[model samples]
Target: MTDDNKIVIRERSTPSKLRYASQKLIEMHDQLIDRGVDKQRATLIGIALHLESMAQAAESSAGPNLTPGFVNEPGSTSELLPAEILAAIDVPPYLSTACDTALRVEPADVPDATGWARLLHARCRLNNKFTGAPCPCTCHGREA
Candidate 1:
């Protein structure tokens, strides 16, 4: 086929774990708002927005293939109370710690990788362990 006659197809990029988690939180936020329970819980929406921005920033900085190593499922909220849903999707603390760890890692450790790449790899290494877990480098909370 001639180049002009052939169709070009572009594959969609999969979202990183951070993006996925942000989406879940947004979903919960919408549901809570729908039921008139947003009140103090409305922060979920803001957090989700921040996470989306962070995901974009990470992608731009690390390359388009950045993916964190955590799994976040929103599960079935139909049977749960709004408070329960809030508790269920309370991921910022873990993510914050992970981000902190990612940002604080020494550039020398990852050699030629960019800041976002270091974050991505560190999150992967920490995988599903974002809950107050110490960074593998033993430098969680320490400034780089």
Candidate 2:
């Protein structure tokens, strides 16, 4: 408790809290699956997208200090930081594929020329699929 009517923080965020949050998210995932939303890839994509958004918001609120370029010397060529530019990179190809899967579009619908990129990311071909692409159809993408 504090004079400002807010609880005073005495400890830093711990791994236990992170674990609990992860577990709760997993439980919510299970519940979603039970509700006929069984697309694991798509679910993961959605979660990743949500997390990235949250990270961007945090980075923005923390201002210039959060990026690697903020510490550049006085004579730097540009104001934009390289790290910030990298952070704005588009969603990964596999993640995009997952989004497409969740949206009920065939893999062919996404023409980003990253077919082999999925393999590099180690996100494809986990179970019973010839290519690195998993069975996106199993994840409610067709009927959603």
Candidate 3:
């Protein structure tokens, strides 16, 4: 078949990290139910699974518009869902605290290493800020 007439199907080479984590939670829930663990434990896992699904949906809807910074910006989506989900699942306090701490970091505090700069660079490229070339931002070492 000619290239224009041939059909093609492309699939993701691997599931997203969040999807894998959700699958693991499902496996844990199944194991708990099969082993006759307490109903409350299984119920908590179910809640976690639901929360993961919600997060996935939100992420999908946000798509390329999602910014990668702390939830400090007004009108931006809160980055605390992961921490809240951890708390709901009754994980150790330290783990939840760590999640909260990580999400609360200010991008300006670590501009070079933070996702905020990468996102800005991407926007710059998309806007052809450098004449249809990669952004010359210092974040990527171009000295702009």
Candidate 4:
């Protein structure tokens, strides 16, 4: 704990703690699913999205540090980390169809591309609809 009475978690290797957290999140996910939310979306939002937000908040509060950052180099060029993520996944049919239509249309097809871009980043974390609908980390642009 710090002067502000906040518990600070430093990064370290702890397999048992990680397992415990995972189990607890899974139990919470099951409880949430029982309440009527879709199982896939429930797990994604409850466990994955929440954890990601926590990680982002922790890193943000840590401020600039001499040690290298997690996702990128200490200093790197500007590029869409999120966009690059798209190429790595086997995109679902719904998203691929949307992409196909977008490619055929003119740039002026929609008035506010920027607005749509932000929204897409905020919400559309496409789960893998093929096997298990696991959460893809597409919601990185969310305001933390």
The number of the candidate with the highest lDDT is 1
Clash tally, candidates in order: 0, 2, 0, 0
lDDT of 1 by residue, 49-135 (tens): 557656665555455322343223222122223555556765442333444545555454653234343444344323222233223
Q: How would you encode candidate 4's per-residue C-alpha lDDT over 43-143 as one tens digit per residue?
A: 33344443444455455445643433433221233222464566677755443222333333424456334433433344433333232233334333322
lDDT of candidates 1 onward, in order: 0.47, 0.39, 0.41, 0.41
For model 4, the superposed segments whose C-alpha errors exceed 4 Å read 1-10, 37-144
The sequence of per-residue lDDT tens digits that candidate 2 reaches over residues 14-34 is: 434434444445566667667
TM-scores of all predicted structures? 0.32, 0.25, 0.27, 0.25
Q: Residue 126 lDDT in model 3?
A: 21
Consecutive 10-residue window with the lowest summed lDDT within model 4: 71-80
Alpha carbon deviation, residue 123, candidate 3 (Å):
33
Evaluate model 3: give its lDDT.
0.41
Models ranked on lDDT = 1, 4, 3, 2
Q: What C-alpha lDDT, on a 0 to 100 scale, does residue 18 get in candidate 1?
A: 68
Which 10 residues in a row give candidate 1 its minimum summed lDDT? 70-79
lDDT per residue, candidate 3, 49-120, as tens digits?
544544555565555434444322222335434545545563321212222333444244652234333333
